[model samples]
Target: MAVSALVHLVTGGLVVGGALLIVLGWETIVQPVLGLFLIFLAAELRPRFGKVDEERLLRRAGVPRLFALLDDIAEAVGTRGFDAVRLTQDFAISAVPFGLRRRRLDIGLALWETLTPQQRIACPARARGHFAAGDVRHNLMVRTALPP
Candidate 1:
């Protein structure tokens, strides 16, 4: 993670620095165009971090029992409960950190149907465990640095 961060920082710095140099160089026929291109490239390489949108991909899990279960699991794991619980048609479970201190959880309806009650609980609990263990933040940092 540290190495990836360092690489990202160095690469991003070089890109921006090159753009600055091009813009600061004495006027020339091609300098403005080249400087603009370099500036755009720098912007593309920069990391962007933002909260995940919850309204578009899935609907919030409104079932009272499910919310209670999630709360219990969150308490057991010693982390704040998820900000939103979403249901989807896919076959996976995932959790993501949002703005500031919020986190969101998504459970696919297909996956939910396949799991036994115990397994259902275990799924999100495992996801929450990743957050509690700080894996989520670490992964986010690495991803932000690397982009695609």
Candidate 2:
């Protein structure tokens, strides 16, 4: 996925460069208009990067026990601790990268409400597995480069 993102970036760069050369080499109105269109295309393909708002998410300070469980899971999986834990309405758990090395874990309230304690542990364990496999970085790259 990182490779894909790099490819997209390079392609965007080439498009913009070629467009600029075309506009500069030719004085025609059509050439400048085409260059502007290519520039727009490059902007659209550029990755969208952002950080998760930890303030809005349920923090460990507010729910120590839950974070402790997550800590245990992280230890068991041999992965680093999560940056934050968030509650959501969806019936799924997700580990999302915020920036370079920051990862936030999102737990669905509906899923937590339905599952037993053991089952709840499994959710994050599986999410941690992605990190354990060392694919989180690539996953983040793909996610950032692609449009939803």
Candidate 3:
């Protein structure tokens, strides 16, 4: 993604510079290089410039939404326990499974401030592991928790 962004920026600069050169009647090998740079830039950037289809899915679902989602997630897993969730960064979120069977969903600042010591330790591992694994689904769980 970073490469794509860099290419796009460089290519865009070259295209603009090339156009300006043309307008000034400055015909030189540089113009073609600039133009080619732009094409190459676009090609390199194309992959990163695509639309993000996961925005809705990535959204924090908020407290109410989380409640509903976690409720379902926990129930699905047959755990009476749930996890406390948080949005750790711009790109992803985290959650730590809790409860007997870990079927329940805790959310928001209020719940976060009230986690037990064990929950706090366990939460971050879950969230971080999920993020490292590139699983957006795990992002919904609490990766960190507050101390009791």
**Alpha carbon RMSD to native, model 2:** 2.8
What's model 2's overall lDDT? Answer: 0.77
Please provide, for model 3 over 34-147, each residue's C-alpha lDDT reduced to its tens digit, 9 standing for 90 to 100: 666655654553322112223322223445664565455444444432333433323222444333223122234454566786675455445444434555333222221111
TM values, all candidates: 0.75, 0.79, 0.26
Off by over 4 Å in 2: 2-6, 50-55, 136-138
Weakest ten-residue segment in model 3 by summed lDDT: 139-148
Winner by lDDT: 2
Report the lDDT of model 3 for residue 86. Answer: 34
Steric clash count of candidate 3: 16
Q: How displaced is residue 22 in candidate 3, in Å? A: 3.9
Model 1's TM-score against the true structure:
0.75
Those runs of model 1 whose alpha carbons end farther than 4 Å from true positions after fitting are 11-15, 50-54, 57-65, 136-140
Q: List the residue pairs that clash in candidate 2.
A: none
Candidate 2 per-residue lDDT over residues 31-127, each given as its tens digit:
7777777777777676666556656776778889878988999999999878788778889998877666677888888888999978888989999
Per-model tally of clashing residue pairs? 0, 0, 16
Preferred candidate (TM-score higher): 1 or 3: 1
Predictions: Cα RMSD each: 3.1, 2.8, 14.6
